[model samples]
Target: MANSPQSKKRARQAVRRNDVNKARRSRIRTYLRKVEEAIASGDKAVAQDALKNAQPELMRGVTKGVVHKNTAARKISRLAARVKALG
Candidate 1:
């Protein structure tokens, strides 16, 4: 029900943004899942590497507005702790 031209344009923009954000979120999740799988496999080295890779992706998500800053920080902190404990 976007009667106004501006509203219609906004709706279109929203759809585009939704697609981009969805892809970004999915990519971030893939990175996190890699770390989790490595951790589950009990491979400390691989887990550490995956964690290192995922940390930046998560932070990038925060910067891109795809994720909340505190949420990203908490996730990274907890994952780091888990990686450290794998020793």
Candidate 2:
């Protein structure tokens, strides 16, 4: 119910942004899942590499406003700990 032209434009922009954000979120989740699977497989080396790859993606999510800074930090911290414990 965007009656005003500005509102309609905003709605359109929001829809576009939503799609982009959704794609970014999905990609981030995929990276996180890779780390989880690597960890689950009990290969410390693979898990370490996966975590290394995922760290930047998670941080990118935070920078892109798809995730909070502390949330990204916590996830990276926990994943790093788990990977380390695989030793």
TM-scores for the candidates:
0.98, 0.98
Q: Per-residue lDDT for 11-56 in model 2, tens only?
A: 9999999999999999999999999999999999999999999999
RMSD of each: 0.5, 0.5
- After superposing candidate 2 on the true structure, give the runs of residues whose Cα lies further than 4 Å from its correct spot: none
Count of residue pairs whose backbone atoms collide, per candidate? 0, 0
- Model 1: per-residue Cα lDDT at residue 23: 98
Clashing pairs in 2: none
Worst 10 residues of 1 by lDDT: 76-85
C-alpha lDDT of candidate 1 relative to the true structure:
0.96
Residue 23, candidate 2: C-alpha displacement in angstroms: 0.4
